[model samples]
Target: MILLRSGAFFPLIVMSLAFASLVLASLVTGAANVSFEDLLLDPEGSSLLLVSRLPRTLAALLAGASLAVAGVIMQMLVRNRFVEPATTGTGECAALGLLATTLLMQNSSILAKMAVSSVTAFAGSAVFLTLAHRLPPTQPLLVPLAGIIYGGVIGALTNFIAYEFDLLQYISVWMNGEFSGVMQGRYELLWASGVLAVGAYLYADRFTIAGFGKETATGLGLNYKSVVVLGLAIVSLITSFTVLTVGIVPFVGLVVPNIIRRFKGDNVRATLPLVALTGGCLVLASDLIGRLINHPYEIPASTVFGIVGTCVFLWLLYARPQRRV
Candidate 1:
């Protein structure tokens, strides 16, 4: 494996430049006739750019970065490289929360829905962690397999409830991640997820320590439980916000961080920024490809990433070395 040490200046520069290029591509690649001239000269006059393109691009970037960070946080806390928020019932529980809010408080505001989703997501994550603790530590791969099954059950429940109430369409919006509907006013809530991702960086050292196991971290004077709670909160809130805004973009959290950790190592403080940028680049590039692949018709970013993520996941599962969590 090629190990690139974290905090390297060159990698950051390259990733930043690639991210910028993807953002520009996302801004201009749509059904509307937006040009570099229109972007540079009449930036505000183009309703498509102002109303749709910019918002969608921002949403993609925010969701990607936040989810990738959340994934890193999850892997750190769970000590399982394969685990992520989506696999561990967090996203499914968020969908359940959204479904409940839609059914009960049909007139509730978006913030209200997000609050409910965050609570449910947190509760679900806590449950998963409890189950994880019960699993034999020697079987490292079992954690992710259990998480996938746990998430599947919650997702099945959410789907059944949504189908019963004729809200499958509503639930599907959160189940699948996409950015086509994002407009200026509709996507600002994702900024909170971006903030929370940054917040996670502040506690990166604690998380890295926590990954060494509760006893070790506690022996070293870390507040193990407090750090776990904080990590769960960050993961849940980020998941809720992204799910509500752009749907659940699967494999972002699963694929991006593992790829980073594989080469960059797990120094959260040094590698966190690169993980966030690479994630944003992945989602924005996926979004742009989805838009251009079908021309006037668009594929969801989730679909594009699903194919890519699955391939990478298989490669990781078979080709890479596994570590005990």
Candidate 2:
């Protein structure tokens, strides 16, 4: 009847086990190796697990699921599978908002900063949507091209301002995706994305319907404009919380949903969980690989995903099979 009918569930079972193993690997790897036995005998290992490892894993899962769903919603709303918060101007606008607050309100709490960033994100995404709406929909490649240029312009402006004000170091920290510094109290805000994912799931059908165009959705008793706005709001919140907590990571949203959609069709209602699960798995795997690649030192998740996701995205664009079973 749906994606579940095609034996997708088996792959999900396999992915779930893989995800569990990765989570364990995250909890176990690091400068201070942790084991289950350490929980009973080694106080230092226990503290490391509790304070750093667990929080880092939670942050990756939350960000992954949040961004994956956010990407699906964006692609559906814009009718382009390549668009995302990073490719659009959402993350840049958020970084700009944080920079503004740093200069203007030195005493602002992180939550307040996130509020400002969300507003900026909404504005930036609105601009991208407007511009995307102007593009020729027949050429899908043009959509992400315009988005990347748009994001680049915004990001460059933010960087220029950062340099002028000597905030480059702080902006640098806010612009890269890394899990090395995530710890208790710091990474908890990432769960906001997880909560929003639940709402995204409930509205999955509406977003999917909207992708078929306004007339189709309207004929089906859907409020197309409202759905778009709601989707953008959800994306804004996810983008804000994610960038505010862990800097910006690219392609999780763009890559994961597209990968799942290839097999599951466009039925987001049936595929949303897989999207979330796969997103979480990819990010967790990236973080784990980053830890091991450089040994006692570390690479950022962005570095790993940048190389890997770019290759996968290219393959999807070019080498993707001409036929699907």
Candidate 3:
């Protein structure tokens, strides 16, 4: 416990420092090279800074934090460290909803598309939870495997529809993660995830107890069903908001939380704040490196994360010991 707490606490401080550096880098290191002097001295430059870089940095931080928290909550709820919004079909459902809105409505705005996407993603999460309830609880891997299979089916259906309708390009652009386009008024949807993250912190204990098992949680006087539903709802909201704003940044929800738990233990309540901070730092770092590596071109933050996370995941798989749960 002492080691875990120490490990958990120190990373938060480091993450905070890294986050600040990344934000500063994001503002100054862009293609235009808007300096601090330009931001302070010129009105038009100041507006550009506020309108462009500030919002994008904020969006990246919020998206990272929200997705990380959602991942932690989901791992607790399903008792599976590998499970995440993307793996569980929430992202695909959101994409389907957005695609449907664009095809059916013909004149739907981004907000309208996001609203529909959020609703559908919530429904998809509900389906996963329901399936979880019906299945005989066994190993943690089985639960996430079910979710992965479910998500795969949904994703395939989505791809088929997009192909049939000749909207593959639109789907392709939206499905892959990209932060280059974020600006003021465009990334506000991510604020919803911030709200949900707060709610998750408030109910962290319930989630911890619920993770012990439904019967155990019930015996402990916690409302297991309600807690599970609340956690799922938060995950759905976070996932949908992220998909709508920056597209799918896969493995964040799955990888970050698991990595945190190795050092912090499975104390969801105590670990959430650190998870959020570390997630933000990781994303910001990835975004900054992506920008610098290609100089003027800029790689997607998601691509960086994917490469880094896959390696980490492989290491974990190799090092992980078999356990009796």
Model 3 has a clash total of: 0
Give candidate 3 regions above 4 Å deviation. 1-8, 109-111, 132-139, 320-325
The candidate that achieves the highest TM-score relative to the unseen native structure? 2
Q: Largest lDDT belongs to which candidate?
A: 1
- Candidate 2 achieves a global lDDT of 0.89
Candidate 1 per-residue C-alpha lDDT over 247-304 given as tens digits, one digit per residue, 9 for 90 to 100: 9999999999988887778899988999999999999999899888989999999999
Candidate 2 scores a C-alpha RMSD against the true structure in Å of 2.0
* Model 2 segments more than 4 A misplaced: 1-6, 321-325
Candidate 1 least-lDDT 10 residues: 1-10
- Score every model by TM-score: 0.95, 0.96, 0.91
True-vs-predicted CA distance for residue 119, candidate 1, Å: 0.5
For model 1, the local distance difference test gives: 0.91
Between prediction 1 and prediction 2, the one with superior lDDT is 1
lDDT of 1 at 182: 97
RMSD to native for every prediction? 3.3, 2.0, 3.1
lDDT rank order: 1, 2, 3
Model 2, 12-78: lDDT tens digits are: 9889999899988888888765676785479887888888889999999989889999999999988
